[model samples]
Every structure is written in structure tokens, then in C-alpha cells.
Target: MSTRSEALLARPAAQLEVRQRITVLLTPPGLWLLLFFVIPLGVMALFSFRAASFGAQRQVFTLEHYQRFLADTSAQRLLWRSLLIALETSLICVVLAFPLAYFLSFRAGPSRLMLLTILVIPSWTSFLLRILAWKVLLGSSGIFNSLLLSLGWIEEAAPILLFSRGAVIITLVYIWVPFVALPIFAGLERINRHLLEAAEDLGSRPWQIFLEVILPLSLPGVLAGFLSVFIPTVGEYVTPLLVGGVDGIMYGNLVQDQFARALNWPLGSVMSLVMMLVVLVLTFGLGRGVKVTDLAGV
Candidate 1:
């Protein structure tokens, strides 16, 4: 009957209510994930193990798909090439995005919003359209070739501009640069102006300040941007299909061929799973070394 005893007794009830509320709130999203993501992934995994047979009365599971993939040197090479391309694209995006982000964060002043809008406007258009636009620009008689011809850089149109690995990387970089910049811009915006002023007061040169302070603090955003671009680029098939020739074909194109052209769902599933695993491993491996606080210079 004491007040302390009563309060202790009520605590369990209060905890129960909180738990119930949390469960209720989480139920919908949990179910949604199970229904959509988990189920689909499970189905895909199942398909990867299933024997490659059409309209068979009995279903047989085997490891042959994985065995075949492992034995295929060309597939392995293509996978590595895709990873290399993705890394290249991500690095290029970061290099090109940083300066634009820095300017928007520090120098755009009253025009920051307008410039940012301009950066994002291109993204509002269809993704396919953007790629097609680049296709046109890189074509033999496209604007770039014409401009070069007029400038006497080349006597004839450069046929090598389009339908190459370089073209795929170029188009991907252009598509991703604005997106990458936004994250860097956000990170830069979070930086306290006082830090910059203090560095200046200590007589640090612009380059020194950037190297020691700005770069350190902006690393999280840079990593974010890099990963964002890298992950997608690794699985990119459409860009390579449209612009990249045989020499430019990536692992994604191989996977696409399995499902679309070859009608081999099991093999395609195995490839897709392998690509996903590789991406996940790389992402975690990269992220494991750097913490957000470390990147923020906190």
C-alpha cells in the first residue's frame, strides 16, 4: 500500500503499454518488408537453386548453376570489369561533384538555390531520355563530333565516341554528378562557419584549410556520394546496352542476357545473387573502416 510499492507495481504496466505501442507501430512496416523484400528475395534464392527446366513435372535442385558461374572465366572477368567501371565512375563523380558542392556551400551566396535547382532540373526528366540524349551527343555526327570537326580537332567524325566503355562511364558520371553533389553540399552545409574562420585566423592557407579541415569533415558525404554512384554503376546494364559496344559489355549485361535472351532464370538468379553478394561485401568492407564521427572530424 506504500507509494513506492504502488509506483513499482505500475512500472510493469507502463512498460507493457510502451511495448504494445511499439509493436503496433512496427507491424505494418514489418509486414510490408516481409511481403515485398523478404519474400521476393527468398523466391529468387529458391529459383537460383532450382534446376533449369521448363514445364518439368518434377523440380530438381542442384549447385550446377554456381559451379558453371565459377568455372566461367569470362563471367568472372566481366564481373571484375564491372566493379572497376563502377569504382571509376564513383571516383569521377566525387572529383567533379566536390568543387560544385564547395561552391554551392560557400560561394553561391544568394544564388545557391537557383544553382541547385539548375543542377537538379536535369534529373526530373526521364532517366531513359537523359541516356538517349547522351547517346545523341556522343554519336558519330553528334554535337561533340561536329564541334571537334569545326575546331579541326579531327578531320572526320570520331566513330569511337559512342558505343564504348568510355561512353558508358561518361554518361553514368553525368547522370550521377548532381546527385553526388547534393550529399556533399549537405555535409558542407553542416560545417560550422566558425571552424573555417578559426583555421583562417591561424593563418592556414586555402589549400591547407581544405586539406585539413574541410576535407575531413566532408568525408561522410563524399563516401555517401561515392557509394550511391558505385552501387548502381556496378549493376548497370541499360547504359552499357545503349551506348557500350561488345567491348563495353559488363556483368550486368551478362545477367540480363541470361534472363532475357537465354531464358535461363536459374542461371540469371545465380548471377544476380552473386552480384548482390559482391556489392554487399564491398559496401560493408568500405564502410567498416570509417565511422561518421571520424569523417565529421568530431
Candidate 2:
């Protein structure tokens, strides 16, 4: 073969080899996701349309679960309540986390790693254990009530502390702040210090600089934090189950009841699918909205 023709043939062979190597590298994780995530999701999707049977097994397919969920007033209320609580939790986490994130990113000096370690320490413990600790702290005879009694701040140990919506919200906020703040801190750290200096050089006040430079740049972190907190909070069962009392019960609790107590797999699968869809929709919608908002403001 001519030298040029031989080089052309070699190039295609090299490209094929590279493509094969890339596919081999990606195949394992792709198969893992297919086995663990995609297959289960497919099964759940198929089962969502199946009928729930009691004493006798039903081999028929139906939309009874989805229809019932849509038509039932209590179920609808629970869905809305879950959405509201998750939104509120995300908002509060952002508000509380921003300052801490900013400080950690800009002002922590040599202790930044140490402070971050402290923030993450709680997460190393079991989630249920943390919730149980909150239960103890907020119980009528718990430390909070005891302190109030000793200080004469309350006439008696308040009965509304544990098993209340407030307790649920408080516990959620405590658990999720680290998830939100760490992302925000990472986003803040990526911001160029020169930009802030240039904003100040232009006679921008601190607030102006933050609004113009810092906030806009840190948005990726903020959005990440919101998603991390909001998505899981919407499906939160444990915190609400333990501390929410009757009033604080959320959509997830209902789903859990269907699977565990009611033995209604089809119905539970429907609810789980619905929750997953909502999370997916919110993720795309909020991400687009954030991009638009940033562009419009800028």
C-alpha cells in the first residue's frame, strides 16, 4: 500500500480502538445503574397500573391506584402538604446556610477544613439516631422543657413540643442544613476573588457587590442545595412519623402505610412513581427558572 493510504487505514483502526476502550470503561457503571435503578424503576412503573388484591390475587391491570390518589381529598391534601413542607425546608436551609457558607468560603482562615468536618460529623451518625435525639430534646419532659421550667419561662412543660409540625420542621432543618450548606460553600469557593475586588473598585457597596457578583456566581451551589434538601424532604417519612404527630403526617407516610401495613404493593408503587415524577419535573423546572432569572436580572 501507498504510505498515505496506509496512514488513513491506521487512523480509522486507532479511532475504533479508542471507541472500544471508552465503551469498555463506561459499561460497568452503566450496567450497574441498569440493574439497580432502571430495572426497579421499570418494574415499579409497570406495577403502578396493576390492581391491588386483598384475600385473592387479581391478575387484571387497572388505574385504580392513580385514580384513587387523584380523587381522594385526604390524599390530595397530603400531597400539597408535602410540597409545602419541602419548599419551606429548602427555603429555610438556603437562608440559614448562605451566611455560614459565605463565612466558611471567605473568612474561615485556617480553620475552614475543621469547621467543615464539624458540620459533617453529625451526618456520620445514623439518621434515625439523630431524629431520636431530637425527640428526646423536644419531649414534654425533655431538656428544653426542663430548662424552661427551671428558668420560669413556661408555666409547665409545654405539651406541644414533641409530636408537632414545628418539631418535624425543626428536625428536618437541622438534618438538611449540612447537605445544603456544603454545596453552597463549594460554589462560593469557586467564585473569583478578583471579581469582588473589581466590584468594590467600581464603588459598589457590599450589598451591591453581593447582589451583582457574589449571589449570581454562587447560584449553582444554591440550586444544588435546594434540590438536595427539597427532593428528599418531600418524601420524608421518619421525621414526620416520629415528630409530626397526627397533623404532621405527609404523603410519604401514606405510601409507607400502603406498602407496610396495607400490603398494597400496587398502590404504593403508584405513589412512589408519582413522587419520582414530581421530583424530576421540579428539578427541570427550577433549573430552567434559575437560568432565566439570572439572565433577566443580569
Candidate 3:
């Protein structure tokens, strides 16, 4: 009887060891993702289906909130405007980031890490503070105007830089610039310098090399960076609220209003879900176009 008990214990221990090893390789990441991503999405979905009374603390399951979001012309206009602004911001970010990344990868002196760090320093500081800094720099009494006046570039301070679409775009570009750069840098870094050299050796001009070897190789990075910034930028609430006057209030602002002032949770959720689908489609499309988006590197 004692021998049989000992044999059973030994069998379980080996199985437990195998299970532990398998779990060690997979469980931590799975658990973390489940806790953070899945849980938040689940909560959002749950609340999104509920009709919200907000300050009055009343909620009930209903489709009225969603119907209102779809049927209201004002809401649709706001949503369209928000999407357009976000798209503009992303395009600007991509254009600015690509060249900087290209230079950093192909040129910049040997202190590459230092250069990257410097480029990202502005981002390390407070986001709100950065936007405020833009406000001051662009204000009537700001340094930009004073400098122009001192240099005689213009007789008066240009007051055209504040509280408008231009202001919002400039601030957003500044804020999202680093996000765009890092992914591009990562993409460029993964590139094989040898392949670029080979293209050059084959009498490919610098432009040709970029068009053929560099561009294709870096597609993944470009996409990764675009999606990283684009999705969140679409739903941005703060930049629109702060820098955008009448022209700058984006769809995110509408979402906040619907929940807080309008007491419409279902509609907010629908908008959120629609935004998610748009992002997902963009991501998948980008991924398909550049299969390397899933690759370990260029």
C-alpha cells in the first residue's frame, strides 16, 4: 500500500513539472493581457449597452442611446469632423516623422541613440505642459511674434496662431511626432545596411535605393507607427478641448458630452465601437499590404 502511494505521488510530480514549465512560458503574458486589455474592453462594452442618466445616476439596457447617435444630424456632423481632424493629424505626423526617421537611420552621426533620445525628450515632459508651451509661443505677446517684430519679418505680432484648427494641428503634430518617429526608427534600424549598399552598388541612385529597398523594408515600421498614433488620435479629447476653439472640438468631445450632459451611454458606446472597427480595418489592411508588419524585423 505504501509503495502504491509513493508511485502515485511520483507520477503526479512529473506531470506537474511539465505543466509548470508550459505555464511558465505562456501564462504570465496571457494573464496580463486578460487582466488589462480584455477586462477594460468588457467593461466598456457592458456600460456602452446601458442607457446612462449620468449625474442622475440612472441606467437601463436600451437601444435608444445608440439610435439617437445614429439619427441625430448634429452628432453625425461632429463625428465626421472628428474623423477628418484625426486623419489630418495622422497624415501630418507620418510625413514629418518619415523624413526624420530616414535621416536618423541613414545619416545622423554615430551618436544615434543620443539623437533619438533628444528627439524624444520633448515627449518625456508633461503633455499638457507641452500644449501650454505651444500656446505661449504662439500667443500675441509670445516669443515668435516678438522675434518676428525684432527681425522686421512683420510690423506686428501675428495673432493668427491661437485657438483654431491650425493651433490644434500644430500642437497635435508636436505631441504625436515622437510616436511616429520611434516606429520608423525601429523599422529603419531593422533594415540590413548591406542590402541598401547592394542596391547602390547595382547603380541604383539614392532615390531608387529608397524607393526599392528602403521603402519596402520600412513599410512595417511606418504602418506600426501610423496605427500606434492614428487610432488614439481619432478619439483624442484633450487636444481638441484645449487648443481647438469652435473649429477644434472633435468627435471625442461629443462622446464626452453624450455621456455627461446628454446622458447617452449606448450612443457613446456605438461611436466607440465604430471607431474600433475603423481602426481594426486600417490595421489589418496595413498589415496585409506589408506582410512584414508581422515579421520580427525588416
The pairs that clash in candidate 1 are none
Span of 10 residues, lowest total lDDT, candidate 1: 289-298
- lDDT digits (tens) for residues 128-197 of candidate 1: 9999999999998899999999999999999899989899999999999998898888888888999998
Q: Which order, best to worst by lDDT? A: 1, 2, 3
How many clashes does the backbone of model 1 have? 0
Q: Candidate 1: lDDT over CA atoms?
A: 0.89
User: Which residue pairs in candidate 2 have backbone atoms (N, alpha carbon, C) closer than 3 angstroms, thus clashing?
Assistant: none
Q: TM-scores for all candidates?
A: 0.88, 0.88, 0.81
lDDT (C-alpha, whole model) for all candidates? 0.89, 0.86, 0.79
By summed lDDT, the worst window of 10 consecutive residues in model 2 runs over 289-298
Clashes of 3: 0
Candidate 3 Cα outliers beyond 4 Å, as residue runs: 1-36, 54-60, 147-159, 289-298
lDDT of 2 by residue, 41-142 (tens): 998887787776453445678988889878778876888899999999899999999999899989998899799889889999999999999999999889
Query: Which tens-of-lDDT digit does each residue in 1-298 have in candidate 3?
Result: 8776556557978668767878898999999999998997787787767766454434567776567767888877876777777778878898999999889888986987799889988888898999889888878888878988999999887777677778888898889888888888888988888998999999999999989999989887887777767778878888877777777788888888866776666677777876777767866876665544423222
Best by lDDT: 1
